[model samples]
Target: MGENLHEIWLKDALVFLFAAGVLVPLMRRVGIPSVLGFLLAGLALGPFGMGALAERWPLLEHLTFADPVAAEPFAELGVLFLLFLLGTELSFEKLWSLRRMVFGAGGLQAMASVIAITAIVALVGAESHAALAIGLALALSSTAIVMQTLTEEKRAAGPVGRAALSVLLFQDMLVAPILILIGFLAQGQEANLFGALLEALVQGGVAVAVILLFGRFVLKDAFRMAARAGGRDFLMGLTLLVIVGGAVFTAAAGLSLALGAFLAGLLLGETEFKHQAEVDLEPFKGLLLGLFFMTVGIGLDLATIWSELGLVVAGLVMLLAVKAIIATVACRAFGVAAGHAIETAFLLAPASEFAFVVVTTATAVNVLDAPTATLVTGIAGLSMLLTPAMAHFGRRLAASVDKRAAGEAVAETFPDLRGHVVIAGFGRVGRTIARILDAEDADIVALERNPVIVARERKAGRKVYLGDASRPEILAQAGVAGASMFIVTVDDAKDAAAMVHAVRRMRSDLPVLARAQDAEHASLLYEAEAEFVIPDAVEAGLQLAGRALAEFGYSNEVLKDRIAVERSVEYQRAAAPPA
Candidate 1:
């Protein structure tokens, strides 16, 4: 039995890697989210179809090498890395800057959603404890799925995207306490509730103290030393160690590993190495996240779904509808435009991955039975599958709403255009480029589809247009043809490439400078014949090398030569035809 388990584990890893290699590219070609593909692959190899694998194997089920839990530490590691990355993206300063959105809007959404869902569950005849647990679980949106989709759609830095991220971040921070509350509520006994509550408060206090101390003093020096070591592999390893170590420490203190990871990331985010940390962790983050999603697929029991098909479908629809309506209401209350409010609600209507964690924990604590847990999990999974479709539906709904409110001509025109460089996005990379361009006396005609960003940018005295750049009419109205240079700074490589193609057709000789956020994007831009393809990673590497050389007392000429050699090599590699 041991040997069979080992063999199956190895086979599964290989199959997973192979499938990922194929599925990611195919999904990209089809304009589908890679999450959908990952889930589909799991369904294909899982009990639903081939039945070639089980959800768990004895030797492969450890949290760490020696731990006995069936869920590997890597599964937790995936969540840790995700939270870490999220933290890196958000700093305390930035969080404070957006306090109203982060706390006011985000807090209201969480509170309202939980209350609304709790009521619905109770109305459906669930026990109070079960109803509360379900409501809490449903209140949390999938930060992983929502953020990933927004990123893939090139909307992450947009107003709507930032607003979504802020809400998700608040929800993530809320998860730790919420989990503790569920545990207490599940116990039901007065003594147990009091004891649990006391323990939780103490644990939460300690965790906060540790994070504050680490962030204020220790992490900065530690990362500084690591940065000076100048070894890429070492840096990557150190990053994983911090994430895992933080998670372990948090778990030991009775907190969620995901929360620990997030806190660790938040601390690191305050340091200079934040961007580099994001770069170092990319490969591992992607692979583990993919594996985590695939594992989710593998764990799904098709037999159960087949037996409870109607219940499962009904649960999924009900969850989506309720969440969507609640979210839409919340967004409107926060003053989002009707169209954007609907889009925001739809984008977040699906149940989050965190729901699985909540439901599973509730079941373990006896607040929810196995059947209830399974039902919630299946519904959550189905909601994830429907997320992209819901986003599209919301957009259509928004457009319809807009058309009815104003004439088509008024609705079609993206207002307030002057001297603005018309950046189609405001993502990290896009915003960076925009800042640089803004510094160079260029007025930005920022055209962003995310309503939140559109509002924010408009307030900042920059003209922002709320419309898609790929639409020729949208582009024309943004003065793309007449603009200085059309900058394609969207996160989606395919979309960026398509926009470039469209721009070229419209203005044959226009200079289109694009942000190649990664090697894959750079290659795509090169193929698309973009005038200037800025490989963000390669540029960061060059900057690091230049600074290191200077610190080593190298002459200016020597440093220049070093940079030239690196550039020449990169250019040669970039220009080489794909294998």
Candidate 2:
């Protein structure tokens, strides 16, 4: 029996690899998001799909997952990596800066969602406890799906992305208490709900304190020691250890494992090796996340949906509407723009993986019946399946709103502007340039795709506007024709190149400057008619070498001359075409 189980595992591994390696790439070529691709693949291969006929068509057995639960452990690791990577992108200081949105918007969104959902469920004839359980289960959004979507769309660092993340963070904090409440409901009137909740919160607080303390004290030193061990393998192993160790610790404390991983990432992000950690774990995160999506797909019961098609569809629609409306209002109250608030609402409207856990527990304790649990789980799964599409639509809708707003503001903006800098992309690099230019009191008009950034920067009294720079109309609107210089500081290589090309088409004599990730990207930007292309990697190397020379007591002038010579040589080499 053990051998048989091992064989089944091997087949399942093959199936997972097939989806990640083959199906995903094909989906990408057709412009489908990888998250959806994995879901469809999982649906096609799970027991309810191809595996249901394995006995009649034995060959199908090797191509499908016989048991959905088998992949749950690895699926969970995917969630850990997702949260950990997100944490690595943030610092405690940045998190603190978002405290208002996190606590205010996040708290309101959660509370409102639960109350609204519970009332609706009760109105539909569910018992009070059962309705409450359903509300708690379905109120939250899928962290994995939403984060992955934002990351894929390059909006993870923007206002909407950060806003979504803040709400999700608060939701993570609520998981333990929600579970406790469900347990209390199961225990009937004899159980002390407040006491159980308070106890869980206390335990959770202790667990967080311990994790933070260890991270603050030991995390940096451990990473430093690993780096000093003279091999990347050591660093990689240590990273995995930290992720898994933190995850296990939190799980033992009756909290979410992903929360522990997120804390570990937050600590590691504060260390110098944060970038290396991200680079090492990226491949692992992608594959594991794909598997996680597949597990969600597997949990989807098509038969149940088909049997109760009308009810399931109505429930899904109602879930999205209530959550989206509440989330939008909550975000809007916290200063998010109307367009971006709507986008965030759509991004977070879907039910999350947490619903399965809540419903399953409620069923086990007799608070919810098996059919109700299955239906809720199915709704959650189907909602996740729709997340990518919803997010895409939200972006488009937001862009439309932003374009109209920009048009209305255009006549009063950039009036008779000439010899001013026209900057594309309002990200970190673009903002840095804006700061330096602002110091010089240079005339500048910046165009950005993210309305949230535009709103925030405008509130800070900068001339940032919402418009995609890749379009000729946006460039014209930004006064690029009369600009002294056009700067393309966007992080996306393709977008940067496109912006340069668009500028060159309209203003052939305009001096265009662009940012590139590497020499290859520099060459591409140059080919796109950018007169000046700064390769980040090459410049970083030059700066580090110059700093090293200074540390070695070299004269400042000598270091300067040496770095200049190297820079010229590197740029010239990069400019040349392939041999």
lDDT of 1 by residue, 143-248 (tens): 7667766766777655567677767767766766788888788655664655665776687669768877977988788777877888877677777788888877
Error of 1 at 542 (Å): 19
> Cα deviation in Å at residue 12, candidate 2?
1.7
Which candidate achieves the best TM-score against the true structure?
A: 2
Please give the distance, in angstroms, between residue 537's alpha carbon in candidate 2 and its true position after superposition: 9.8
TM-score for each of the candidates: 0.70, 0.83
Q: For each candidate in turn, give its C-alpha RMSD to the true structure in angstroms.
A: 7.7, 4.6
Q: Report model 2's TM-score to 2 decimal places.
A: 0.83
Error of 2 at 348 (Å): 1.0
Candidate 1, TM-score vs. the true structure?
0.70
Extract clashing residue pairs from model 2.
Answer: none
